[model samples]
Target: MNASRKLTLAAAALALTVGGGLAVSSASAEPAAASRSLVTTTAWAKVAANGQILGGQGITGINKFGIGRYNIGTAAGLNGCALLGTINTNGGNDPGPGSSSILVGQVNGNTLFIRTATPSAAGSAAVDSDRPFSITVVCP
Candidate 1:
C-alpha cells in the first residue's frame, strides 16, 4: 500500500483503540452533521497585477480601473466586515528589490476597492504600481 494510505489506516486504528473499540469495516461512512450553521462568513481573493483572479473563495468578479487600482466584487455584503490585504509574491518567490504596499477599502456593500503602490526610486513618496495581492474579508 502507498505510504499515505498506510498512515491513514494506522491513524484510524489508533483512534478506534483509544475510543475503546477495535472494529474494522469496509463500508463507507457518512459524515456527522454539524451542530452550527455552515454558511460562509468570510471571503478571499488573490488577484494578479493585470486584474485577473488567480484563485479564491467567495469572489464574484474583478475590474481594473487604472494602474494598481482594482474593484473586486464579492458574493456577500461587507457592511460590518473587516478587511485584510497583503502583497503576494507569486507563491513565495522573491519579489526582488523594493517593497510594495496595499490599501483596501469598501466601495459598497459588496464591492472592495484595492490600491497598490511602491516606493519611488528616489524614496521620496509612493507611486501607483501593478502588483499581485491577496485580500480577505470577514463578516460577523
Candidate 2:
C-alpha cells in the first residue's frame, strides 16, 4: 500500500478506537462531561541544525481527550515563534490503553497544543495526533 492509503487506514482505525468521547476542549464551550486520558512520550532534547546542542527541554504528554502538551523547559532556543506538534499511540500505530499526566492550572509560555483526533460536524472523526510527534521550529 501507498503512504497516503496507510495514513488514511491508520486514521480510520484511530477514530474507531477513540470514538466520540474524545474531544478538544474549546475556549467558548464548556469542558466535556467525560474526563480525558493523559499520556506521555519520550523526551526530546535541544537539537540544532549545527552540531551544537542548545539548552532546551521537552515534555510530551496528552492532557485531555488526546490533546497533548509538549512543554519546552529552557529559553535558549525559543524565539517568540511558532512550532509544530504531532501525536501518536505508544505502539506508534495502536491507540489503546496508556498512562496519564496533567497540570493544575495556568497556560505556560512553553505549553504547546497537540491533538490526537479532530471531530467533524457531520459526526465523522478526523484522526491527526496518534504516536510519535515531530515538533520543530517554523521560525528562528
Candidate 3:
C-alpha cells in the first residue's frame, strides 16, 4: 500500500486497541470512584520505514520511537511502558529474515509508543527476511 494508506490503518488499529483497553480496566476503576481520579491511556504501534527494516537483515540494531511522557496529576503518573515487537517472513518478496524482539517502550505521559528506527548489521543476514511485521506497545 501507499504511505498514507499504511498510516491510516495504523491509526485505526490504535483507536480500537485503546478503546478495548478501557473496557478491561473498567472493573478496576470502581476502587478509585471516591478519589475523583480520571485515567486515560493510549497505546500504539510503530513501524520502521521499509528501507530501514529491510536493510538490517543480519545486523545488530538500535531503533528510535519519538515519544515523551505526560500526566496531569499526582494520582495519574505514568508507571509502566513496555513493548512486544517483532517481524516475520516466509522469505519471498523481501530478503531480510529475522525474528521478533521485545524491548523497552517510550513514555509520554500516560501514553505509550515504540518503534525501531535504526537497523544495523546482524550476524548472518543482510536483507530483512520479513516484509511486514508489527510493533505493539502497552501501558498501565
Question: Which candidate comes out best when scored by lDDT?
Answer: 1
The lDDT values for all models are 0.80, 0.37, 0.36
Strongest candidate by TM-score: 1
Candidate 3 per-residue C-alpha lDDT over 1-140 given as tens digits, one digit per residue, 9 for 90 to 100: 87765665565567687883212232332212233644333333333334243332212233332221111111233465344555444254433334333233444453323332213437543322223344433345
Q: Write the per-residue lDDT of candidate 2 for residues 1-140, one digit (tens) a residue.
A: 87765665565567678873333243322324765755333234332212122333454332333333223332323445445443323244434334322222213554444333333212232333233344444333
Instruction: Please identify model 3 stretches exceeding 4 Å from their true place.
Output: 1-41, 46-79, 90-92, 97-104, 107-132
Looking at model 2, residue 37 earns an lDDT score of 55
TM-score of 1: 0.64
- Taking the tens digit of each residue's C-alpha lDDT, what string does model 1 give over 1-140? 87765765776778787884433444433323446733444799888888889889989999999988999999989887889999888766524348778999999999999999876433433477778999998776
Deviating ranges (above 4 Å) for candidate 1: 1-41, 92-96, 122-126
Better of 2 and 3 by lDDT: 2
